[model samples]
Target: MDSDIFRHGGNTTCDIKQFTIITDKEMRNSMEYDVIIIGGGQAGLAMGFSLKQKNIHFVILDENEQTGMSWRKRYDSLHLFTPRSYSQLHGFHLKGDPNGFPEKNEIAAYLNAFKIKNDLPIIHQEKVIKLTQNEKQKFLVATPNKTHKAKQVVIATGAFYNPFVPNVHDGTANFEIHASQYRNPSQIPNGNVLIIGAGNTGVQIAAELSKTHQVTLSQSKPMKSIPQNIAGRSIFWWLETFRIGRAKPNSFIGKILREREPLIGNDYKTVQNNVEIVGRLSEIKEGKAYFNNGITKQVQNVIWATGYRNDYSWIQIDGVLSNQGRPLHSFGVTNVAGLYFIGLSWQRKRSSALIYGVSDDAKYIAQKIQQHEMK
Candidate 1:
């Protein structure tokens, strides 16, 4: 990203440098560390900064080719839902107005600055394919090309795993793309578009496509919406002030907050009236999509904006994961010695997986690692 790529909301130019982007082949055949953190998203980066503050030896490994490609690869109009004040990680302040929301690229740039400023040790293009414990009571992380050893392993791989695209067996649409693969309006075919899943991504993508194409949102019911701002303050401010975002997972209030409520930001305001809402997709056959309510539409483009599922097949440890393949950690610490997780939804609280909230989990994990070392 260019240094002059300043956010108009904050009118601040990014002055910090970027980190070195390394590839898998460039990685050493073998490496060792006091701690190895997987996934260089907000959670992993936060842990890196916290560990560096304590002079701990650690390395962050992510499969992305660039420093912040995770956000950079998202759709063009994507922006942080929360205000800038609520979107920063540890050690590095985001260069945008506290009350303003930053676009996706701004976030990618901010993370690059965060990595460079804190001098976080990160290995790009390195995907951990397998994780197991050796008899020596240390972790052995295996990638396709190399192996790494660490006293502790922190899987900070943030959420948003594999895209869950519903397969209709019979190809009814000319083309289909998931929101993760969606870049811009041009990605959609020339004719009408059908968007599945009424979550945040589905609503956002439908809004974007309505600019040049007729869009029909296919879902069981319209996503619930909440006002982004209340009176003169952002909704996040209220959430923090009322302690709603930090509510316990099992609490009644937390359960209500965790329920998916599609937020319509500036991205969807204009297209709200232009798109059509339909029931859940019941079937697809002969170039026509049918919904549960007997609504049928001919669409050339289809966007599967469904949610994701956790994939921890690499973590070969028993009893560490639940039957559904989610990490069973308490505030980022697992019963497994020197094993931990961060950036998991509801890992500690409602905001635990989000950018603004990941630092809390990371800091907690760092302290736990330090305590474990003393034992």
Candidate 2:
């Protein structure tokens, strides 16, 4: 008899089969599938659609309790940097003005509806803890309570994982929150705010908070600013019209563009007049932030928009990730035979991580999986 323990809802655990229910036995037995995707975000859902088109039996394992939790958990005032036309998955158009940008909630709702409309099979609240390949070349994906066996696995967890906050803040701020955990200005204190990292998220939040509070933005490096609209059309239109959006990462144009990501919005302009911009944050001592340029500010609250790092530690497979824990693959195909990754920034082109670009990678990956099975 197998001595494996059965766990249910993270509360009950039992090793004796007599004490465990029939469903527990079923849970103990690994659910076999042809393909297993380790995320349920837009990338995973998009891959599901492609796999479904090819009649592949696959399942999306989502850590969240419901679909679109990733988007729903973002800042309340968040909006897509790309327009609706460029914010859609395969086969379904995001409703409303194609030229207009969608709100975070709208994107979340659309993702949920997309999963329902496509009838994609997803197992929610099953966060994959460990992924290892057996001698038979079958992947054993272990969650807290269940283990799934799949012939192939796709990691669509996207680029964001653990929030990356530097050691600049020495626990002196009255209150601090990462941009990932920030909701709105109301959630912040009424005093002056210091936002570290001048990325799009940092700039947008600084602009928003400048309306209600004194704000200072900390810039780590010089960020190129581009207008949201150029010549009365979205900048994306111009990029697409000139084929700049499709530039491969290895190309000269792609190399130049990737050198410094240009901020795509007028929010920087909006904040320039109201918010005080400073250089890199050197450190925080006694709730006072010292800049590298010998400037200091007394801030009541701090928001770290320092971005995220992809944590591939859960993926125990060798030769799939680089020394820095980034996926090492040509586009999405990894060196490992049955392993693949999607939704990585600059995975194939400039738009590989964007909503509109994932379908292309998904279709390609689904075809690759089909071909592998056929062989």
Candidate 3:
């Protein structure tokens, strides 16, 4: 937590730390793989396993102490809307109670088992600091400990790596909070809470906190939300059966639905209508939120579910990223040779972001990698 590393706009400023390049002796001693996946999340592990099935050598690098560390660190009550069957990794199905959605801990355990069962090679506690391509087209992945080179690199870091919190007007000096810092409802102060962002995360947290605290949700735009169940079947079932969940993000219907739909979760109409819903918060001053409607409310806690920014600042490859910070890729193939990306939203279709649909994107990327290798 270096205070100087973060700029005034809440963006992180990078000061390159000293790194030790792997010497020839170290490279000879260390195991080299055909592919190096930088992340151990569901996508990373699944991609690694797929590569393994073809007997393609690959290694997974994770910053955490263990697999599924991201899920394990999330809030306790978090549960996947998609049932266990659809959420399982490649080559294996979840064996637990299929009727129920898996909790965060359950998913973490599943990932751990997936890694062990398939014997996927993973280096935990290694954070990738810099990723640059050498003149020879080998990926130079530098971690805090050492630098390793790989023929190909897969950026499987999930979308939620960075949490976005809009700046509070008075400065976030007093209210020590961010969406990433929130673990549970108990972490919120014991008073009325004003939550900005009516997306899934905001809606879920509002519903949970409504049980004990006075909660209000502020929305910048109307959201589309489906109930957990509809007509004796889970909403997810309908989405899967009709392939609504797999629709392309760029499709006319997808664009229309995404714009008109309200943010719905597992349960239908779980949020009480009586709960206050207001316009977006314009600013926060002296522990109160000022809304666009000129209304002011004093609150002890504010949860910003604004959204996330793609933070690939560590990637040193030029021309791989657009001005907007999103990777410039077609079907996960970046402009850089041997660098591929999967699990990104709208990478192929609208469903690419969903847990159940990520596998399709992963498979496509894997096929591309295979074709590139054959060349």
Encode model 3's per-residue lDDT on 123-169: one tens digit a residue.
88889999988788888998877788888899988766788777656
Q: After superposition, how far is residue 181 of candidate 1 from its true place, in Å?
A: 0.7
TM-score of each: 0.90, 0.91, 0.87
- Cα lDDT tens digits, model 2, 172-218, are 99999999999988999889999999999999999999999999999
Model 1 lowest lDDT segment of ten: 3-12
| Best model per lDDT | 2
Candidate 1 off by > 4 Å: 1-30, 264-271
Candidate 3 lDDT score at position 66? 85
> In candidate 1, what are the lDDT values of residues 174-286, reduced to their tens digit?
99877889999977769888888877788888887888998888876656667677897898888899998898888898777677555646545654688888888987788
